[model samples]
Target chain A: MSSTAGSTLTHQETDLHLQGVINRPYQVVVWNDPVNLMSYVAWVFRSYFGHSKEKARELMLQVHHRGKAVVSSGAREKMERHVTAMHNYGLQATLEEAE
Target chain B: MARAFRATTRGYKADLESHERRLLSQLCADVITMLETRGKQLTGDDAPAGTDAEDDYAHFRRELAGLGDQIDGSDAAGGLAPPDDAALARLLPDASSDPQEAAQFRRLSESSLRESKLADLRAARMALEGEPVSLTEEQAPVFGRALNDVRLTLASRLGVEDEADAEQIHQMAKAGSAATTEALMAELYAFSTWLQETLFSAMLDVMPEDD
Candidate 1:
């Protein structure tokens, strides 16, 4: 599904094709929880995932507004690890196969 | 008691009175016990033993099936398993959307997670009991984690959903019309949140700046 005007393959199109060929990634989704503070969630994102402060806040806001947000996507093992870590930190998180 | 935590040469320090130390230790101990109990339940360690051969065989078959499902990552025909209590639910969230996958993940990781939580609580309790209460840089994170857990438990009990709820609790407590349990829990929740925030800031102060 190329949206670009150019007939030649675009970088975005190529990346999508590569992702289709490779093993499908699994995503770790963090859900909004009443007990966890927004600032704390942002801090966890920054500290655990090495995300920058701005990016962490952006993800945290998405979780707040959207009920949940995909915080990380990768191999099944890594996603499982990330979900466990989130649970340890007392955040509501779940893993799902990425579409 | 007064806010006791502060930055220190070693890492972080808190000078709590004997009673305060006892209270903190007791809270941590309670958390440890609850987590251990829940862990046992999750792993089916608390399953009742069967006296008859047929019953024993059935139990064995059930355990074998569970192990097989965990290995294959099959979805158990159900929604998420409900938490034993609100506090436990807050402490341990589901790790996967699929019911079976979540059960498998819980079986694999719940023990280690419980152990780490227990270790953190015990570390905090030990520091509270030690002469000249202090936590080294390494130990401070453990204490922080324990504090976070306590706050989560208290907040869950208090039904603290957002800032507005917290503010209302404080106002009700101040008005002297609130129930004793609600007032006391709200106070504890606020205190724990303050302590956690202070300790976290102290820990951050000691960290080396990025190049």
Candidate 2:
């Protein structure tokens, strides 16, 4: 009986692990575009996402230099909403399945 | 006449002469018209049958049709596609790398997004149309967004890619050369940027110090 209970607990743990694997977090990536000003991008990061000015500048520089930067990561729905908001603010953005 | 925007106890206030107000109203009206035209074009109706615009829409539709395997069924809304124009593309960027996901994002949000911009433009126009061009607290953000959109459009058209480019344009404008289209656009871009900055500063004045 004890052996059966232990096996059941192990199965539940495996199920949870599989669920975690299947539901990996999604990331919102802001892509650098020539049209948007660097100052404007930093301001959007600071104001919209409420990041610190320094942090915003760091992220903006990442985007400018690397062509893109993952600004936030979370559940797929939240990431989608973030991408949409970024679009509304005239910034190029996308969602990616997190690595 | 030098007119600057300032934050008032009531909201944000800008003192402008009648002609200046009239010109601003006209500009807002023009932007609204442009946004509406773009919105129609997105739905694949405004473009003629065999034009590039229509072709682009067809491609988008085909991409969307093939997206069933990638995206969830509930995310597909089937609205307009992305714009081909650089200015419109800047204003409404794709929200996803995947064409299917981007199309779904556009379908679900583009109309409302366009409407919000239109609403902002309208609010600014209405405020200017009044005797006193003052924006309420709620209306201030709308005006600010409208100004930003106008500036974005102008900057895109002027090809102001970076600070250096914008600075050169500013110098050209300051030299008082309206002889070229680039010079004229630069002047307009500078004016719009100044106006937007003024409004933003006014809003900043009203914010808490900690912010």
Candidate 3:
């Protein structure tokens, strides 16, 4: 229950909301691979995710050095489609629950 | 589209040759190092980070994708370097669709055509050994086409069409011109590396969450 001092969430309402509400976030995770080039990875992010070249490259670098990066968070189905498309394009990619 | 034959030919064998493969792998390692360095540059620079490296990487990927698209387009256009459809037919397990069948036919035709080139090489070797064998008129064309195919395949893959240029580069490299070949090899290696990275990044952006 996200109730605070200034917020008027009545006790009855808070109890009712707490009964059964779960927020499940899906995360798009890119994995490091030996085959792909870093620049190419960045380009892909730009093209597919509509990320600006700079943002895409930054994400690519993070994935390159860090070995992985969560590029997006949203619905599970959307993430699945994205993963499949990446695989089709010859990239090693996957999805996971957002931490 | 109707199938048309060009005076040109190409093969994947050369593209995936042992030496080429080895060179490509080495190039990939170098690219990784470059990526790491670029990343460091981004992190170390306090001034508007992220843009420079990212832009460069995107351009690199676009170059690779452009190369791929060029080759595929050539195949469609039935240019002089149209792939050997006949060889593909022989290799394909099944040709379910018309397009698939067409590709196979092109591959097979090229292979059958290249057999004569192999024979010519053998003949040349025999001549060097002081053994002579006469060839029929038909046999002569086979050798010519086979060699032509090899040349075109290399040309198209490299996004070039000038046979003269290809031969010149080939000769220079064979003659131990290290600097020139090194530069060319570096480029090809970068291309392959970029291709791999582009696919990886694209997949990461689009893949769904696991259960």
* Candidate 1 lDDT over residue span B111-149, tens digit each: 687788888888888888964578887777678778788
DockQ winner between 1 and 2, please give it: 1
C-alpha DockQ of every model: 0.37, 0.31, 0.03
DockQ of 3: 0.03
- Per-residue lDDT of model 3, residues A1-99, tens digit only: 122456465656666445333235667777764434455566568767788767777898888788887787777567756654454333445556667
What candidate 2 gets wrong by more than 4 Å, as runs, is A1-16, A31-47, A52-69, B44-81, B209-211
After superposition, the stretches of candidate 3 with alpha carbons farther than 4 Å from their true spots are A1-22, B1-211
The per-model lDDT (C-alpha) reads: 0.71, 0.72, 0.42
lDDT of 2 by residue, A1-99 (tens): 012333444655667665566567889999876545565676678777888767888999999998899899988878878887776666778888898
Which pairs of residues collide in candidate 2?
A: none
Docking class of 1: acceptable
Per-residue error for B148 in candidate 1, Å, reads 1.2
The weakest ten consecutive residues by lDDT in model 3 chain B span B4-13
